[model samples]
Target: MAAMYQVITPQKPAAILKGVGPKVAEKLSSIGIETVNDVLFHLPANYENLSVMNLADAENNDKVTVMGTVMTEPAVAYFRGGKNRLTVFMEIDGIYVKVTFFNQPYLKDKLIVGEEARLSGKYLKHKLEINGQRLIYEAGGGFRVTYPMGKVMHSKTFNKIVAEVFGGFSFNYDLPETVKAKYRLLSVREALRLIHFPKSPADIKEGRRTIKFYELFMFQLRLMEKRQKERVRNERYIIDYDIDELKAFIDTLPFGLTGDQKKCTNEICRDLKQNVSMHRLLQGDVGSGKTIVAGIAAYAVKTIGEQTAVMVPTEVLANQHYQSFTDTFEDRLTIAKLTGTTTRKEKMEIVSRLESGEIDLIVGTHALIEDDVLFNRLSLIITDEQHRFGVNQRKRLNDKAHRKNVLYMTATPIPRTLSITTFGDMDVSIIREMPKGRKPVETYWRRYDEVDEVMASIASEVRKGHSAYIVAPLIEESETLDLKNVQEIYHMFLDCFGEEQVELVHGRMKPAEKNEGMGRFERLEKPVLVSTTVIEVGINVPNATYMVIFNAERFGLSTLHQLRGRVGRSDMQSYCALISDPKTENAKQRIDIMTSTTDGFELSEQDLEMRGPGDYFGVRQSGLPEFKVADLAEDYRILEHARLSAIELSGEMREDA
Candidate 1:
């Protein structure tokens, strides 16, 4: 159950426990700020102490709060492109001043001709204009110190305690002096005061430093605890297989497996052939051929007359794997799917086959974990996009394998340092190569208005017997950013090309419908497919040579790359065009780097630096333990320190025990 939040006065803060929240206290509970500790830890995101500066001295257009009177009334005017702008012509002192408030209807009523108020905001002077216009800038600072009007202006509501504190009141909490001293951090009250109404930039920096450290420390502690729990379990599996058969299977492939793929595959096969059960993780980049390697491992167990269960994060991926395995292994393996969409009769047959030891492999979503799906001699369990499953889900799947080997596959590149700490208990293998003959995709970032020209180019390729994928970020329109929906893009393509030219698939579609839609695209029944990221993984359409992503800026670096990876599979030259809006430097940089390089490892490193570890891990959706404070990719130093500390503490605990 979620914790009940309560606010306690300075005199009785300690008396109020988790369950002691009053009715009103429950109503006023701030999201993210749950308990007394949460309230204390809710340090300001930033601080702003308004420094008064003369209009002339404020170079680089710094925001300034200045006393001014409305010398003229605001006029509502509409421009040529239906733009409604409110011009507030203000005159202050002997020198004339003009302020233009854009698109604010009530601004005309709020500031009268004779009214005097402080106009605070960033302003820039137009050199050629007769009158320099001041544009209002929203004040940014800690919530508590901002004025009531300021809070009301932004429609933000805070606790009464916070409101009072912001209003210049102080509170006394029972924080231990020793803890504070040890951390060399400021007191809660002092930190809050400085954060809310900082007098200087240095004060704001200090306040943030103190709180950021605590947050990082707590995050490290949680990761360590989780790591400790996983280490204590005596889990093992052994694999014994004919090495010659594995080698023969590899040799049979039309294309030779890369050295990296072979190395990673050997790592997995080695683990399974061990005395202890293998808990292994396979990390790779998009199109690095992790799935092909997975097939070899699955077959190893199958050869030993044991059933293997492979779990994928999505139905599409499951189906893709099912097809791929069935195609390669043929009648040699009795493979079945147990997804949510699987019919009762189909599921029953799968269950019976599994119980009877007739099924060689099983692929599905969470449905594979159903109580009735009993397995006979289940020796190998594999999961794709391992991050989507929680630790418990992975454990449950592992439990099904009994003493069988467990292999987890990820498309996201894990930072080296994080890989060490998170997968401490699991043997790790990384497949970092694409199959030979795979061409590097040409990536481009362009504006939405360039859609017609891009479409013309894609259509030309389509006429030449090539295929393309037009991907949108969302299936349907949401209240968020104005992005092209799958439905909208699908129709737009049909209108641009023809109704018979394009097909659409999204998560909202039924399983059969989605499969059919994807099949049409894959088989070239439909030359162009417009869809969402539901096609982000495992739906291979090798003939597709053009990949266009709308609102590409909104997608994580890894996801964008993966979407691009869908193409460039065949011998034909492929192009990945990113349809971005008025591009920011960061967005341009990301798209440009992808365009310039085909190295997944290099791209992963750049992704780590640009998007940070959170974005990388978040997109990879690999179910590895996510660190709160430590970026396994970036914060290697902190992770090392925490690891050493954990080692020392564990030794002490063992000695005491």
Candidate 2:
């Protein structure tokens, strides 16, 4: 038998779904064309139906598919001494047309005699004489061959179809009836077909609507599924406590608790006292005293011979809690702090104290959840600014307490409708009122020239034994930004208020230096504190009544809101000054949100509207649902639909479960 060379068939670019080369895959990914399914899902950003008309009827700029042939081969025209230019001249039946392929030296070989190929582009007309040769050029449209019209194609991705079966594909495939009616959508196959090759303009419009709704519906469905899972794993804490003791603790507080705070704390404590477990969120305005309320619930759990753990997002907040609790329930509660700043020996000691139930209240940052730090009968856990904590991280923290009652605090006020829908797992408590003697912070928006006036105001307050906070947008200035760096700003203020009166603090500073700067401000040694956003959270200076934010527009409203909260802690009237450089009307609008209202919930709503839901709550956080196309603020109807859908789906799933 003759040795037969086995013939191998090379895979076509379109046929080979897998094993796409890296460079081609990257290019495809850029256009969102990944897997075969992704290719199918790659709906056209837009569609255009080619106007097939005579060259005479075609407008000068209209893109038309004119059936034409090569009237002549591509020719090269030289100018002056040695200017080489290649040009292709062609014409259709009874229409004078020209095609120019520029600077392509190989164009002469690429175009054969009487060869036919399609070209699509804009039309141009210019009369030029090259090498004494007069050429009348009339450019009308891009060149293209005649084929079955109605293929959806993006302008950038034109000529990308390498598939042979594209023309043979038929749409109108049936989809699940439930999906069709629920989303008011069409089948994917139909949408793809109509988008690429629409029979009419109306078909393309309807196809687009169907695709948009389908995309939105799928996102809502995934969110609903997540809500259901959280519900299934729900746990309410067992609060073993005497009701009278909790009441006594509340009544004994120096100032009366706000009705909202009391009500929320009761709800949380009730959940803790339950047989199952409690996972609750306590969201309030800045300076609303969420920490103190959390401390009360934590102490309630400690009454039953169990320890309580409070985790803050930053070390400053942790230290604040450590100092506050250590003073509030002094001797009654043994409080320990565990942070990155804690030495190995101190950590081990704290860990030992925690395991032995000697530490009644442990306040710290992420160090509280490290592997070696175990708790003995940890019955309650509270997380400050809970949105910053990861889902898995919160789970681990709660698990470390072995499913103890969880209370999460957030200075960011979420809307009630949003809270009930996305945060359904947790019972919410809102602190709408400030403690008595804590004056409402007065806010002001000033242009750069008024900076001296604001600083003078801050200095006047500081001279009266009051403290002030000077905040900057960044620790250091970027090449693009001409704003003063935090250190430089500190020196400027020091020159204004003397070196002994002002102190500087930034994230890049050593922990001890930060603590020192903060301590000096706290102790009134340095009444004016110049810093970055690191001081935005959990810095309680009852004496600090003035907050001067430089380049205010560089910060977001929510963040600026938090910074403003650092003041107005004392009975004396406090103030916040937003000093914007090169201020414009847009800058005024942003800063005006703070100056207009002291209501955090209102500010939160406005921030949500301005920044969109995903960005306002941060992209990788648990507090808000991720929405792609639907605007939570503008698309309240869609939000309602998804919310109702989630409620109904969860209700049904729970009943069945």
Candidate 3:
């Protein structure tokens, strides 16, 4: 096996593997496993430590080993098209359990009738169906590694195939010994072996940690290089305003700034004066007065005789910011808005004014990045809800100026750990403090059976002259819940609250239609607004005090928090009632987290833990590179170590250069 390494290394393709054929190789390639190294590096989504149990003892969603007799022949039924759902009728100590293997028609031949077999899978409670059930020859011993594309092949088969290859494979991507020793990093060989076949749970954990470090370290090094190159080329157009001017501007505002807001403002002000182009991420929870902080930055740019363009995610958000900025500036400077709904003639005029620098500060959506829309001496580009804009869109708008300074504002608050690691390229300024007079939303969790009580509470809030948001989860992705429709729920609300008091909004609604629905709610014409997650970041109404999210299990911790944030924008006592009977532990955790804290940062941290930095916020959307083994949300400490190491390595590279 050791001698095989001399001849067959990672450079070889999957075709050289012991059992891989044309079809198997083709399936493997779909998951980016074309090479032998790819197979070796293919990480597991999760591992299940097999626990042997009888079918009678297995509860719902339990990962238990069932040593059973194949009581019936494996029956395969064609579903939809050429694909098949294979069901194997098995008996564990006279108790029947149905094993389901989706899209694997060939598994029928493997499950022989009238024979004893060992199966490991998640047992669906109430019913005897086992989802993701894998047939194993061994009864029980070690953990089962679940792959990303397990639907195509059995985990047992993958284990055997990889073990044969691992016999010869050597981990070659090792860092310098000095760097490794300084960071207390593991050798690639040990890391890979333990990550794949760990002897203990601690081994799996440490193995994951080491892999995460390697990924983040390399990613940071690459980003540091790009950042260094950018700093050399783009020098900021020096801002004329100082901290004193920013303070004076804030003083005129209708409200006082929180300490966190003030600190963030000072950081942004300091960055504006620097010679290097300032790139910053301003993160605050919803209604945390980040807009006012942004207003100060925009005003500073205006004083410097430069224009600023504020880009937002939605048309409603663009309009809301336009009004907010207009009120804040109060004729101190010029402000304009350009949205997709803007007429052809109005858009032309707005573009003309922008080109002539007539608009001192313009707030708009993606329309601001249009090719024909040119800016005169565009100094600062501030993007609100930074995750909404594409990386190219932001770059395209920023390229219009000679030396562009960008400030990204996000109401989606993240923990400091994620902020540092995810946005390593940008200087981060945090506004953790919510403004005074903003009420903490009272949150509640319930099962679907308690909908009547939630509805009654909404009516009570509405009768008190407060508005309510009826957030319904659209089951678009799930086939099991295809019959369930949010529109049907909207109709139910309409019947209960009257059509005049209820308005519907969803992703499929036309912009005009959706805006009208939210507009009516904002104007107080409608006391109850039924919407999908489409209203996640839209219209902000201070009067809205009741927010009820249906099927809360469908949303992530981060999303649920954001939805809850729609209310509690004002001093009025608000309520966020999360309604769902979550079956899975993960679903229960999300609901639990929401009910526990109104802190966006805390919820985001939990979200990162429960669901690994999913495309929930800016991690994937902001064009930041993703890690293979490292999760900035869970292994944030690892990220910090990698970031520091990368920074040191970057300094050495610069000195050598």
Candidate 4:
């Protein structure tokens, strides 16, 4: 039966359908609809309630469908900008009203004088006007589903295509009968049909609920299967490190580890000692000292004579980790750095040493995932800024080892919703406590008119032997946006502070130039560095005491937090000035939140609610599955129910197998 269902499924190209030629198919593809299944799943964005309403009872601007007699001839009148309006007189419930259609001249031929018709649109009671777009010469009406592809294809054409497809065949229900009964879900065919053409509002709601649950349920099932596959046990990968040696190493550190850091490190070490493969996600806020925890885990792997690969997102970050690890391990371990800028000869030498087990830890960017880079005994893989890399890239790096033990670290705290859906397969550990003596960054929101006051505060801080960062959203001035750019800020700062004291860095700059600018800022040679959001992640400067972001409303709350993290790394009192004149309510809320609290997790939750899951991390780069119906933010309750159902059904299927 499953085989038959697979064969009968409508996986054919949309062009195979009648009236869907190459041109129409191309238009469909433009909106991500390519196959018959795609067209069926392209659900309506909204539904137009065309239920008849009495003209006397209807309020102003009320959406209504009225059955009335056309009393006057439809006359086309020319408006400004060469636009035309078709107007006619209609008598509904014995009240005459003017019905207007803008730019729809063809309707004049259909709305005949002294004829009966139904018109659906917004009704203006004071003017006795019914501004309408849908004029049907038919008899009955209910709810009209409005597809998202109004610009791609006409509503009538799309409706015809959908009706033809629905009339063509039936869909196979994949969910077991018992499971369907348990969840009170509609079958696939019934749900799709009702969602496309529902008789009542309840039908639309029920159909959408069923589809959303099924989508989330199937997604959870796939994740469970992957989790099962990754649960492979191999005793050879287990590490037995010397506890005394690790403690001694920790004692040698300049500062004591935070409780959260210690707890996470212990969690990671325990995972390494187990026989089963380890897949854990370490979430921490910016400046929470996650690197040292990861460093401790890597050192544990090294103690047992195994190599660890530390992959970071940027070359600058790779260098930072390489230096930190080299400093920490001093003469005890061999560490190497690999990046795109590494010379071919140096890269080959490093690769040879790594293959020969001469190197204990290798820190790199995407260069570490190249096929030629082989490890002698890769036991633990640590990916920093894990969100910046896609799942396939991480998998490629994990494939280098037989028994996979991956530790993914992200400074950007994952929202609770994403932690359950996107990283559901992995175990999670969070480091919420900052290191001792580190002060929280003082955050403030200032209007663009107060730029001079903000600059004065920064100048005062600079005079105290501290450095500052001026971040802008764009590198150059944009014709459309009236926001400040890095170039303009850099020159302005250069005039205030000497050229040698100001440096400019942006994404468009050459890597070497950017690195040089950042290096000068780190050395405090440049007291002020104007940059774009390129400095958002992995650039740590403890001596920097001030962070000023121009057009702060342009950035997400999570991003604003990350940029603020660049400062307050040291014990010195640090400040972050958010300078922007926010216009919209959302923009104003972002600034208020930025000034209110410094908690990354809280800000991330607000960000998820405001921008939704798609833009939380960019949709394409987020490595999350694209659901046809379920939304991770708005449909969280449905997601939870579906997850539980998937777990129960999966267990039953396993028993039967």
Top candidate when judged by lDDT against the true structure? 4
Every model's Cα RMSD, please? Answer: 8.4, 9.0, 7.8, 3.6
Candidate 3 on 576-631: residue-level lDDT in tens?
98888888888887888888888888787777677666565635665545556766
Backbone clash tally for model 4? Answer: 0
Cα lDDT over the full model 4: 0.86
Candidate 4 Cα deviation (angstroms), residue 1: 21
lDDT of 2 at 403: 51
Lowest lDDT 10-mer window, candidate 4?
A: 1-10
Off by over 4 Å in 2: 1-37, 48-237, 415-427, 436-439, 476-478, 582-588, 617-636
Candidate 1 lDDT tens digits, 391-453? 677777777765656788887776666565456556688876677887788878788989998
> lDDT of model 1 at residue 585?
83
Comparison by TM-score, 3 against 4, better one = 4
- The local lDDT score (0 to 100) that residue 432 gets in candidate 2 is 89
Clashing pairs in 3: none
What are the Cα lDDT values of the candidates?
Answer: 0.69, 0.69, 0.79, 0.86
lDDT value, residue 318 of candidate 1: 88
- lDDT: worst 10-residue window of model 1: 1-10
Using lDDT as the measure, name the better of candidate 2 and candidate 3. Answer: 3
Backbone clash total, candidate 1: 8
What is candidate 2's lDDT per residue for 1-657, written digit by digit as tens?
000100112212332444345665566666545444444444444443344345555555555444456667778887786657766656654655766654545556655657654444445433311111112122443222222213333333432442312443333333346546785766755665566556566777666555544444444445556544543344334556767776777677777777777787778877775666666788888888787888888778777778888888899998888888887887767888999999999998989988988988898888877888899888788888887888777777788875567778888788654665457656678888888767778898888777888888977887799988898877776898878678778878978989888888889989988998898888888888889889988788888888988888888788888898888877899999888853566566778787899888888878877776667766456656543233456665555554555456556666898
Can you write out model 4's per-residue Cα lDDT over 272-347, one digit (the tens) per residue? 9898888999999989988889889888887878899999999888978888888788888899999999999999
- Which ranking of candidates, highest TM-score first? 4, 3, 2, 1
